[model samples]
Target: MSASTPFVKMNGAGNDFVVVNALERAFTPDAGQVRALADRQTGEGFDQLIAIEPSTTADAFMRVWNADGGAVETCGNALRCVGWMLLQASGSDKVVIDTLGGPTTARRAGPDRITVDMGPPRLDWREIPLAEEMDTRGIELQVGPIDAPVIYTPGAVSMGNPHVVFFTDRLDDAFVTGSGSLIEHHPLFPEGVNVGFAHVLAPDRIRLRVWERGAGLTKACGTGACAALVAASRRGLTGRRAVMVVDGGELDIDWDEASGHVFMTGPVEVERTGTLSL
Candidate 1:
């Protein structure tokens, strides 16, 4: 932390972040510092902390830290929020962001709306990097009574990060929190996983809740929504496109069959902007 460093508080739907531009300044926050900032009761709490650094390959490089002080590979909502901000500042219709996941492109759609090209979904068992090879469409896992499982046969996908989606008739609260927590740290997922509970409302609409890997439950999870659409499509539960309704807001997801890429469109808002003392 600098004596005084600038930051912007922004949110995509309800997932909030504190973004810092570290292009010209050194702003690497350790675990403790990140934890302090994310403590909702004591500090400027946020779901994640983002650092924007100069990039040689793309418009900028994004570094992210989860609320629990752990770093993550990608965050779709953060990308969209930052992408829109950068696009507005540069007057560019498109911006490329380089992340640990890969280089992703963001395009202007409408007023305060951005569409992110999240690339293709990684469906291979090895790509999800499970402890061992297994069918990703429906991994061999179960919850509840062995005789009659409450949640079983979840689909796994990686949208730059790991996720496991359980398509149920309803978004059961207990299931989302209990089963989600247990499966998030399950040994099968060596890298851990975001747990998603989705209920199909129609062929093109679905309601979803996510227990994020390092952040626990959040208002929304862009990557989780993308993963849900892919997982649903894989299981033949839904078409390639759908609207994912989360707690905060709605997101449009399209899994293009032609290019095999997933595109997510949503709105972003700047909550506040100020300087913080590190």
Candidate 2:
């Protein structure tokens, strides 16, 4: 018999994950293994796979893999889930998490809620890493036709990963899943992009739907919510703070004016626990 590893199934809002404690037992799954594990019918179904590893500079290091078996720089919802785990283990109010993006800090906001300081939003075209130098506030991209495009002039921002937010008057599922998938593979974005469809209800509230780079459409995206707030604020569509209403639940997002750091607060839920044969 092969060895098996203990796993925890967790979700932040509706963004689900299969978490492995690499700190307890060192294990890294290859792309094939990741794909097999991500299979909804055959294995543990999840939007992402998170590995909690030991870190010297922070409480723990979070490694992320999208459902498509691709490694990513960061994931806001996953961060919150990992933060909750670390806080519970250490019995601390706050903890720092290290990732490929950088070091991030998370604090206890309330019961079953965590607030993560996602550092600063990368607004430069180079940082967002577009194919060419263009204004990130409103990139020249459109869907449909050139005369009257379906969605155009999207604001680009990087919350450790590439994203583009298109402000629209209405939020539609067909549009999000269809057009979003097209934009995610646009040539302008060299490394692909997470596409956000945002409808600003008020200066302090926004309704958002995200088509993640490798995860398809998810219930909620933590970094997607943060990027929408920042992009909207930059475009004067909303204030620096807003409540992002997603498919699963709501997230409170605040972009500090002074420090320019974005904070995301949301709830985390533990779904189940099991072991995966390796």
- Per-model CA lDDT versus the true structure: 0.92, 0.94
How many residue pairs clash in all the candidates, one count each?
Answer: 0, 0
Model 1, which residues run further than 4 Å from truth? 170-172
Task: State the lDDT of candidate 2 residue by residue for 1-278, as single tens digits.
Answer: 23788899999989999999998677788888888899899989999999999999999999999999999999999999999999999998899999998999999999989999999999999999799999999999999888999889999999999999999965777889898899998999999999999999999999999999999999999999999999999999898999999999999999999999999999999999999985
- Residue pairs clashing in model 1 are none
lDDT of candidate model 1 versus the reference: 0.92
- Per-model TM-score, in order, reads 0.98, 0.98
lDDT tens per residue, model 1, 82-195: 899889889989999999989899999899899999999999999987998899999998888999999888899999999999888756676678878899899999999999
